[model samples]
Target: MAPYASDDSTTGGEVDEQRSGRRKAARYVVPVTVMGVAAATIGLVPALADSGDPDLPKITAQQLIEKIATSDVQQLSGTVKISTDLGLPDLGGLESSLMSGAAGRGEGGSSADPTAKLTELASGTHTLRVAADGPDKQKLSLLENAAEYSLVHNGKDVWGYDSKSNEVFHGTASESPKHEKGKEQQPPATPKDFAEEALKAADDTTSVTVDGTAQVAGRDAYKLLIKPKQSGTTVGAITVAVDSETGMPLKFTLTPASGGAAVVDAGFTQVSFAKPAASTFDFTPPKGAKVTEEKDAGKGAEKGFGKGFHKGFDKGEARKHAPKSEEGLGKGLGGMKTIGEGWNSIATFDTGGEGVPSGKGGGDLGGFVDSLGDKVTGKFGSGTVFSTRLVNALITDDGKVYVGMVTKDALVKAADAGK
Candidate 1:
């Protein structure tokens, strides 16, 4: 998305407002990009084998896919464990930037690091408590040491509460134009979310098969494996553990193309098919606690962490205050588009070189960009390619970004093609 507001003709007050709005939007560039890489890393890791294999009726891959599609599961509660090993360099100041930006924007009352908590999902292991009764009432609690961050979606309200800061992020689905009148919100906090996305590659881009029977969360499950047919993608194979009884995906594992340790392994450690309590969806800000209303909270629920979770902070604020650009460069998520299909697809956008916030809170955007990846030139011009085990993000010198679970060369190629 266009990172900031730019106009050739405007008054001093308009210029000041534009600068302020741009700064807020630019702050999201790093944290969101890093989290997006992490999400892709999670989507490309290896599977965890059960201690014992379970003997169940054999099902074909197509049957398993159908089963998952026809799953009648309307309510459930579970504890999910997500672990990632992207082999990333030490974040250094970026960690502080993430925490600082989160604190600075969300009502400016929180000292706690909610953004750090979310980015942690990209590095180490995390546990989440998820409960959903149909789609309208769902809750995800990110359990931390002596702290918890929750995102709850009730009938009309969506609440994100961070216990460490005692901060409440409030939003209403009815208030967001993006939300449909009778639709349900889907949070990216579930194994099913990862599985469904993986299944989309079951077409010509990948080979799908039922590898075997396995046990997950103390229940028997069918193992559905999807392997990319093309060599350009970094993903090796995506293995999903689909519950035998109810067709729910209990676990998702992604292995890198290079093949060694699994970069991501997320699954349910405990799960119940029974409906969750109604009170689980109800939330109220505590007395004297800070509350921030998010008008566009519904915008990013469908995207990965890189694009979705960060919307809670600046998207609505920037859009409301910033002047509308007919070119759509200032429209953050709206400015993004994907090229290609399936595994090699690249998400592209323009940032207009908006200065990103520093880890010390603000300043030195170029230094932050330099710290991320090496400078390289190609047919698409010079850019930075942030490489990990499974994903590479190319930030072009002209303020364009191309990201995918593909090699650096592939990213450059995509940029050149777009040009």
Candidate 2:
């Protein structure tokens, strides 16, 4: 039977079997290749999309103000760690030391000075913690003494407490009835209003940008970068983590703009919307603690008129030691531009040197004028120029002679000084 014709039949069968095996292998390989490619493409798409949309929401001034007007209570609490730059005005070259003290305090350590305790508490989230940085880091040291401040708003009252000094400042609600004596009733401040005021008082000259997204307390957030319009301020750029869901602020970062120093990061680890304790708004002085009433140091008072106006200087000739450069004096006057119509031109004088004693430090010009009350009544000028003059007999830290000029002139000098 010719060996059952094995050559033709078996060879054809073998060829068919090999073709079937190849197809099976190809079926498995094709899907995996497609899946891998699809995953890679999907991953790359989000990055490309996010890159194209860099402009963050530009919150208008009016929007911010309105938010403040409507808010009732706002509270942010959390474990906070801060790294500050002493080079900035706020830190006052003591940022590192202050941070170290704060860390120690968080670990249940004690500091040598009361201010250190305040710093630790102020930077913390507890009732004792303080909110230090705003739009600019320059105001860090300025608030060092505020370690004991409490901002509380009840449904009908707003109260500010300075625990360090054992004083309570209260602002009555707008709807409250005035005393028969005709005292004007003050209205309580809402949380939204507080936030708005803080934002407004922040360094507006600079612009802020959102860098990207981040995670805070396991929630999505956006990182915002704030830059100063001018130099010499405590803050250069602040990276803030804003909650994605609520648009509320979570964390803050303070860093130098030129990239020379370490960055300071502070954040709220916990937050609650519940109304703060009623006692939070009450200010009762501690036993044996002296209570001092706070006066609204008028604009001139800020120039050095209050009781501690010359705390850093001596009594006889404090002006002899006042800051001389136009920039130094102008810093205090920068806010004059924002003052609404109520006053005329503002000026500063370097009362140091010559016949003036070095003990005569800068006095609060606002307070001095305010004491005169109606006698000094003048509507704030829209285009007021604050002038300052340095007594040539005195010299500044940099060996520069005493300098003085008005706000407008100081700005001009500051701009030209660099030239």
Candidate 3:
């Protein structure tokens, strides 16, 4: 967990046992939003296990960085899948409530099932078609039920199509069409997507290294691992599989210090570096489909790309600024206050005000989040602890949400001190 670190080392690295004995910890945020914390159908391509190739050159951490820093893969196509295991209960409503929590932040309207984009991300297997022709054209399709949930980008025009509902959402984002410096140009995958996002701000809190080689998506690749030096975080390490020849990330995963399974495991099960076909990036929502034109809220908007609240964990601290609060800590979305800094930092929010999401129990953290994680109480004053690989939030009966990448005890300490 990047922001919320739970020191499972205290348990001698046995989170599975605690999970069996206690309330299971559900994943927070859209399954695919932060990292590849969601599942996908059979991978698009079969992964060719690494062939014994002793000649694979050994590259140093610095060499790997240089390769990644200079890599520019302009055209490619692949199958990207995200899988997660937070040991959470099956509360189908967790996604909806998290969306409602966003509405509580005063961002905008949540008319759409706000959770629609993440529907495939919540649990079961979801397969996506990813292709990129250039900076101007990109396409991603999540295939389901004879229909496809797709996002197509051509030039500045973007289209979101839900084949199941025969609905196509259109919008435009205005910006100077310019390539970013040293930005990896591969088709988007959450593991690589969020890794790039987290890497930009990782100077003080992280250590980057090059692990040995591994086969991914039938390609020869080098492994790069990123570990947070902050002892307060639950994140043990983050590993990215980088294409050896092209320096593109072929896979990515976020593992917790708890010794449980991977929390966010996402990568291209099958991939091709070949240039995508022109039609692959084109989309004409089937005739008779509902065509809704929307203002370009942004690329990562509610119904646009990733999960709803993912904006908070996004780069540039957009989630933090979106809910600017007028009251003190834990007052509202805007009232989110931080305790400490770096990886150990704890962000507290008041979910009691109007708009903040609360469950049927009204003001009860567990009720509001509705089965997103294990139900734990005690020094924290009775509530639920929402655990994701990167961050964990303790929603107390007191109407406050304490979140960080630290152990449960750390959250309790923060709660008591704030009180």
Of 2 and 3, the candidate ranking higher by TM-score: 3
Candidate number with greatest TM-score: 1
Which window of 10 residues has the lowest lDDT sum in candidate 2?
132-141
Residue-level lDDT tens digits of model 2 in 1-419 = 24534333222477776876676687899899999989988998767645433344555434433333343223333333344332222333254343333222232121222222233322222222322111111001123344544543343433444555554443333333322111111111111112222244244454655577676655566665555455333234556666655665556664543456533445544444343344434444467644322224211211111111122111111122222212323442232111111111112233232221122221453333223212211122111121212111212212122222112333333323322
With candidate 1 superimposed using the best TM-score fit, by how many Å does residue 128's alpha carbon deviate from the native?
0.4
Model 1, range 1-419, lDDT digits (tens) per residue? 34434642233587777986786688899999999988877766533343569989889999999999877677889899987666666564575455334323432333222333354566568899988887577787889889999877786676778887787776655543244322224444467766776775677888999999888889999999989888888788889999999998899998989898877788999999897888888888899777765533232231222123433322211211111111222343447777877787776777556533322223565567467777888888887887878777788777787767788888888988888
Ranking by TM-score: 1, 3, 2
lDDT of each: 0.67, 0.34, 0.61
Error of 1 at 236 (Å): 1.2
Candidate 3 segments whose C-alpha is farther than 4 A from its true place: 1-50, 93-115, 122-124, 175-187, 198-204, 295-337, 359-384, 388-390, 396-398, 417-419
Looking at candidate 3, the ten consecutive residues that score lowest on lDDT are 315-324
**Per-residue lDDT of 204-303 in model 3, one digit per residue for the tens?**
6778887888888878888888887877677777788888998877778778888777766778888887988898877766787766655433333443
Q: Is candidate 2 or candidate 3 better by lDDT?
A: 3
RMSD versus native structure for model 1: 23.0
Ranking by lDDT: 1, 3, 2
